[model samples]
Target chain A: MLVIDNLKASINGKQILKGISLHVKEGEVHAIMGPNGSGKSTLAAILAGREFAAIDGGSVSYFGRNLLDMAPEERSRDGLFLGFQYPIEIPGVSMVNFMKTAINEHRKYRGLEPLSASDFLKLMREKKELVEIDSTLTNRSVNEGFSGGEKKKNEIFQMAMLEPRLAILDETDSGLDIDALRIVANGVNKLKRKDSSVIVITHYQRLLDFIVPDVVHVLYDGRIVKTAGKELALELEEKGYDWIKKEAEKTEESWRVNPQ
Target chain B: MNGNICQGGLFTLQESTVSENMENDSDKILDEVTSGDYKYGFYTDIEADQIAKGLNEDVVRMISQRKGEPGWLLEFRLRAYRHWLTMKMPGWANLKIPEIDYQDIIYYSAPRQKVAPGSLDEIDPELKKTFDRLGIPLDEQKHLSGVAVDAVMDSVSVATTFRETLAEMGIIFSSFSEAVKEYPDLVKRYLGSVVPYTDNYFAALNSAVFSDGSFCYIPKGVRCPMELSTYFRINAANTGQFERTLLVADEESYVSYLEGCTAPMRDENQLHAAVVEIVSERGAEVKYATVQNWYPGDKNGRGGIYNFVTKRGICKGDNSKISWTQVETGSAITWKYPSCILKGDNSVGEFYSVAVTNNHQQADTGTKMIHIGRNTRSTIVSKGISAGVSQNSYRGLVKVLKKASGARNFSQCDSLLLGDKCGAHTFPYIEVDNQTAVIEHEATTSKIGEDQIFYCNQRGISTEDAIGLIVNGYAREVINKLPMEFAVEAQKLLQISLEGSVG
Candidate 1:
């Protein structure tokens, strides 16, 4: 459902993703693993059409449509979702009102009628079960004083509400405990459909155990140096990226010798 | 050129005119009306019947005669005018007021084109259209829902709508001048009773030369059927719009009053000093709300209204309550403190204020609550927003007397700065002589954070929408306190007043 070709992105004039390319077909889960500062978050941010990220030279296409040209909200309406690494706290806007506005904005863009009050409340009740968000917190301001686990769970609850075609979980597992991680992973797993895809960006392989990926890629120094199947993540976790770095240097040397 | 106070007799325009011809002047008049920024410089071309320049007993007499007031009111005006001469300008407010030449200001100015309309259908179309441009129509039943309106043009109240309906409900809602003529006993009994002539400098000045304003009264055991509103407009140049509003709720009665004011742009600054007083008797409740959008002088502060107001209320009997809510967004220099007095046992006083100062405007406003009887209570919530090169401050006082046992007070003052050049300050004084009294105060200052805006944009909301959402949230507490019909309008007004605060 998506194709990212040689996508290179930078923020604040600092290159994050340097000519890294990837593709995930329909009904697939792709996990991109890396050490600190591996541009894993940058890839997710760029795909979600966030500001402050300029594409140096590359293209991102979703369902054969140019995704880079769409605004952040437009991308969401087009079924592109980004689970924030740190969710914002909007002090007077209740989560219920925020969700209603977001849903209506997307529906309006798609030339659909807004959900009735009863239907909206019904949908909210059904989504609450997926991530187990507290009803009291949902009635209060959006993430005004939510706990870390509650914030992460709220993100998954929102994901379920929007029901996007491609979901990018950026560091969603960082602040989650084992139980919370299981709950979030289970929520994401339940939302999977044959036409949808998931891109998980993490610094460790812990989250992958819950929802195993179909493909694994290692990003280092703004570029993906190696790609393999799910077993590669376990191997990298057992050994380290130092071996991958040395192998990448040798490959660069061979490329210079061949001059291709 | 000399630092001289034009002392002794009133500085008359006739004397200055002859002197201008006799002397070879080297210094020109400071014609800068815009306070360094001229936003609205377009003047409306309309003929006006203006009073002679300057303030004096003669000027007050002329205004009283122009309004055709009674001899009692004329004598009252003369007495107040004489008293104003002995008072000095107050320096407690953080405002740099210019020396006003009483004779140089035209006290009473009215449209010379038409006479007063006896009914709504007889009102001039041109004048009605003028009010329409200002977004308020004089016809009450047509524009306002479940409310009566009194439209004041220049310095006089032109017409009041829904009078008969109010009369049937035992409610008296009309202009102050009309009340002095019709309900002379009530006017005489209550006028200057809450805020007397010796209360303050501005109150004394307003009492002396105030031309017209609104007067409302709810009788015993009766509740007002609809909201009563008054709209004030200053269309004549050099004419200061001085208004006086009084609302009285009798035993077991309830009433709500709303007052709004706006003025057109003029090259010379106009003065708007008003006085408002309300009294709630035993078991009575009174609510007063104001949305002031007078012309705030230009950026450099050349033109705009000098709003010096004195507003107060008294809870005189047991179980009585009084509430004041104001949304002030305009004025060149504003100095006001709408206060309340809790005199009876179990009386309650509440004040909720939202003041915004933009461009070169300056506002120093807050409220005071004085507890006298036992078990009295008061609550105050103030929000100040400062943008451009403006300055806004909240200065308040909460005092509990020794006899005020078991008195309680809670006050919260918050300020929001929109730009680096602007400033916000809060000064709250609490004097509790009663050991049994309890008082709590909270103050906070915040600015529109760049990160907050970016976060909203990351969700695809525009910058303006984001700012609106944030401001609405900040003002939700006070907005929710307004009357249900007025809350929506007040919210929209907040958004428009804070426009361009966000980059």
Candidate 2:
């Protein structure tokens, strides 16, 4: 469903994501695990078409189309969703209105008519139930005055509303209590379809336990240093990332010596 | 949108590069909006009877004589004119007003007609086309059914539709000149009863040279069935529009009045000093709304209208109420305070305003709520949006006298800045002499954040529409207070004024 080739990105002359390559097939779930400053979130941002970081090299393709050239909104309209690690708080913009505008924009891009008021409310009710988000939260301004857990759950609610083909979840497990984490993960799992894929970007394997992944990759020093299966996440959780850091250091030293 | 937004999560710092891009995008939008074409700048060609330029006792007399006013009214204008000469222009507002040459402005300029049009067919086709272009047709059949319009061009009210029907209901709705002749007693009694000529500098000048405006009266125990509206247009060059509107609601009566103003584009500044006074008797209610869209000069702020207006209302009897709602989005320099005098026990006053300024425009507007009698109440809500290199400020005052025991007042003023070049300010003064009085004030200033824009952009909404959404949400509280017809116009004006026609 998505392929990223040797993606390179930087911010203010400081490189964030080094050369990185990854591919995800339809219905496959990929868990990208890393410690802080490993550029996991940066990779997710670049994939979602954020322009903050300068794309130094390489390319990203989604459904055989150049994803990097598309704008963030265009990417969203084309079924590319990025669940923000820190959901923004837009005061005075109701969640219902925001979701409705977003859904209508996507539908417009697909040459479909906007949802009628009743149809929109019905769809909202359905998504609300699927994500376990109450009407009070959905009725209020977008993420305004919401608890950390509620904000994350609202992200999932939006995801359920959009029904993207590929959703890159960035630290959905962060700042979430165990119950809230379970609910969020359950929402994502419920929305999973045979033609859809998910990239769960988290620092720990706790989220993966709820929405298990088909493959696991360890990103260290802006590079994907390890790629394996679900067992790799458990192994990384048990021993932590010290071993991977050491391995990354040795590989960097080798690259410096060989000048590649 | 980026890991930069995740630095500390929730509310985080933006990258300098990202902010630089945002700055460019915002600057571009500000440029576009500031340089936006004035859609109502088209001029109409018709013969106009104009007086010689300059302000003097004779000019004031000429205006009164031209209107064929009574001798007592002529004395009132002459007295106000002499007093205006003795007074100096007030300079307290937060604005850089250019020195205005009163001698260079024509005090009176009216369409040359033998008499007030006896019917719509007698009206000038050019004038009719002008109003039609402004979305305000003079033909009652083509007009909104619920609104009775008085179309004022230059210095005279051309036509006031539904007048006969309104007369049947005992609602006196007609031009000021007509009212002075038909209901001389009512006009003389309530003309300066609410806002006297001696109230301020502009009030005195407007009282002296004001040529034409609308006059409305809702008699005892009657409610106005239709919205009474006045559409003022400055079609003649070098002429100032001094319109005086007087509205009186008798005991147990109710009325809602709307006023809208526009002007053709000119290379020289035009002066518009208008005075609006409304009075509500016992158990009566009055609502006054205005959508002021005067020409706001060019991109370089070369020429526009100097809008110096005085608008006030009085609750003259117990249980009476007066509410003011205005959406001001034009004028090179705007200075107005639509205030209320709560003189009766248990009276109420409310003010809801949304003022937007772009380019080199400057606006310093708010309201004053004076509590005089016991148990009076007032509420004030203001929203200011500043874009380009403009300056927007909310200056308001709430005073509770010693006799106003148990009085309550709440005021909220919020300002939103669109770009770094623009500015927003709030100045609120509160005085409570009564120990039992309660006053609450809340103020906040916010700039449109890059994160907010990006969030909307990520949702497939353009930056312009995002700003519109945010601004509309910010001003919803005030816009919702307008009458149904004005509320819709206010919303569309807000969108077009600041965000442009994009999206």
- Top candidate when judged by DockQ against the true structure: 2
Off by over 4 Å in 2: B1-21, B29-35, B113-115
RMSD of each: 11.9, 2.7
lDDT (tens digit, per residue) of candidate 1 on B390-466: 89999999999999999999999988766566789999999999999999998888765433443454454545556
DockQ of candidate model 2:
0.47
What's the C-alpha lDDT at position A36 in model 1?
73
Give the Å error, residue B152, model 1.
1.7
- DockQ (C-alpha based) per candidate is 0.11, 0.47
Evaluated against the true chain A, what TM-score does chain A of model 2 have?
0.98
Tens-digit per-residue lDDT, B47-134, candidate 2: 8999999988888888888888899999989889888889999999999998999999998999877665789878877788889999
lDDT of 2 by residue, A104-184 (tens): 999999999999999999999989999998778998988878898998999999999999999999999999999999999
Q: lDDT of each prediction vs. the true structure? A: 0.80, 0.88
Q: Candidate 1 chain B, which ten residues in sequence have the lowest lDDT sum?
A: B25-34
Docking class of 1: incorrect
Worst window of 10 by summed lDDT in candidate 2 chain A? A45-54
